[model samples]
Target: MPRFLREYFNRNGVGLGSVMLGLVLFWTIGLIILPQLSMLDFSFRPNLPPPEIGGPKDLYTLENYKYLIFGPEGGSQDYNAVDLKVFYRTLIAAVLVTLFNLMLCYPIAYYLAQTNGNHIRILALMLIIPYWINEILRAFALRIIFGESGVLNNLLVGAGVFDTPFDFIRNDIALYAGLGYAYILLMIFPIYNVIESLDRNQIEAARDMGASWTRIHRRVVIPYAKPGISSGCTMVFMLSAGALAAPQILGGPSSLWFTQLIYQQFNDNSDWPQGAAYAVVLLVTCILLVLALMRVFKVNMGDIGK
Candidate 1:
C-alpha cells in the first residue's frame, strides 16, 4: 500500500479508512471523472439534430477542436481571431486575479494564522459575513456600486476626485474587482491553513538571526507555505477563468470572457460539440497550469493532497 494509505488506515482504522477511501473514489469517478469523460466523448462527435444523434452523420472527428482556430465558418479565415482574443484576455485576467488575491490574502492569512486571541474570531467573522450572501448577489452588488450613478462615482464626484463618473463597467474594472473579491477566501483559507501549522519558533529564530521581514517571508514562510499557496493559485485561477455569473453581471460592453463564448456555443448556437470542445480546451489549459505550478513551486500532488 502507499504510505499515505497506510497512514490513513493507521489513523482511522481499516474499516473507516476503507469506507472513506471508497467514498472518495466513488465521488471522484461519479461526479468528476465520468462527466469529463462524457464531455470529452461528445467533443469529438459531430453536432447533429436530435434525430441524427446516433445516425450515420454522428461520427467522431477533430473538426470540433479545429473550429476553435478556423472557427464555425472555417476554411476561409486566417484564424478565429475574436474567440482567440477572448481566450487570451480571459487567461490574462485570471492570472491577474490570482496574483491580486495572493498578495491581498497573504498578509491577512499571516495575521489570522499567527494571531492567538479573539482577534482571529473577529477578523474571520468580518471576512465570512460578506461571503454568506450568494455569489451572484455579491456580483450584482458590485455592479450597483460601480455603476455610473453608483455610490463610488457619487463619492468620487463629491470628493472632487473626478469631474465625471469613471466607466468602471465598460473599462472591465468591475469584472476585475468582482473576480478578485469572489475568490479571495479561496486564497486566504488555504494559506491560513498551511501557515497556521508552521512553528512560530522558526519565525522567532529567523528574527533572532537578523533576517529582515521580507527575507524571513521569502526564505522561510513562503517556502513552507508552497503547498497551500500553489493550491490557492490553482483554485483562484481556475475559478476566475471559468466564472460565468460574475462575468455576466460585472462585465461591460467590451469585456468578452472566454466562458461566455462557450456559453453562447451551447445556448445561442446550440452547438454542443463546439461547446464541449471549448470546455475541453479550457479544462486542458487549467490542467496544464496546475502542472506548471507544481513544477515551479516544486510541489507534488502529495503535498497538495495533504
Candidate 2:
C-alpha cells in the first residue's frame, strides 16, 4: 500500500475507515457545499414566471428577499401582511415555549437523575411513554380534550366553573399548551442525560456542609448541569420555532405560525423563491441563537452532545 494508505489503515481499520471517510466527504459536499450553492442561486432568482430559454437573467436582484423579509409597499399584487405577522408571532412563541419547557423540564430531569428505585422508573416511563404515540396523534388528542365541546369545557361547565365553554381553540393558550406538550420530552432528555453523568459526591458534600436545597441547587447543581440545559434549550427552541402541525391543528385560523407561512409559500402559492428566502432567514436566526448560547453559557457543543 502507499504510505498514506498504510498510515490511514494503521490509524483506522479499513472497513470503519472507508465508512468514516465517505461520511465526511458526503457531509462536506451534500450539506456544506451544495446547500450554500443552492441558497446563493435561489436567493437572487425572481418571483415572476421563469424565463423560457435561460436560467434567471437577473441573477443578482434583491427583489425576492426584500419582498419576503419586508412587505412590498408598491407591488401590484396583494402583499402578504399575514405572513409577516405569523413570522414575528412564531419567533415570540418559540422563545416563550422554550423558556416554559426549560422551567418545567429541568427540575423533573434533576429529580429523575438524583432519585432511585420506583420513582426513577416511574419518571423514566413518564418521559418515554409519550414517544410511543405519534406527535400528530398527541396534538389531536389535546384537541379532543381542549376543543369547544371537548371534555375539559364540558367538565368545567358541569362543575359550574363557567356558564359556557371557553374558546380554547385558535387561542394563544392552546398554542402554548400544544407546543409545550410536543417539546417536553425533548427538553427533559438532554437534561436527564447530562445530569445522569454528573458526579453526585459534590452534591452530597454540599448537603453534608449544611447547605440549603436552594443554595446547593443554585450554586452547584445548575453550574454542573449547564451543558445539558444548553442542549435541551437549543433543541426545544429550534423544534418549536419550526413546528407546523401542532400549531396548525390546535392554533386554528388566527394562530398561523411562520412555518405555516413558509408552507403556504412553497406548497399553496408555488412560490419556491419566497419559501427559500423564509427558510434562509429562519436558518440564519437559528445559527445566531446557537452561537449566542455557546457564548453566553461557555458550553462546548461536543460536551452537550456527549
The candidate maximizing TM-score is 1
Cα RMSDs, all models: 2.4, 3.2
**Per-residue lDDT over 1-306 for candidate 2, one digit per residue giving the tens place of the 0 to 100 score:** 789978998799989989998999999999898987787677677666765315546556777678865577676656556667777778888989999999999899998988878978987887789879998898889999998999899999999999989888856677789899898888888888878877899899999999999999899988888888888888888999999888888887767788887788889988777777887788788779777878887988786685
How many clashes in candidate 2? 0
lDDT of 1 by residue, 215-296 (tens): 9999999999988898888889999999999889999987789999999999999998899999999989978977997897
235 Cα displacement, candidate 2 (Å)? 0.6
What is the number of residue pairs that collide in model 1? 0
Looking at model 1, the pairs that clash are none
Query: Global lDDT of each model?
Result: 0.92, 0.83
Error of 2 at 161 (Å): 2.4
TM-score of each: 0.92, 0.88
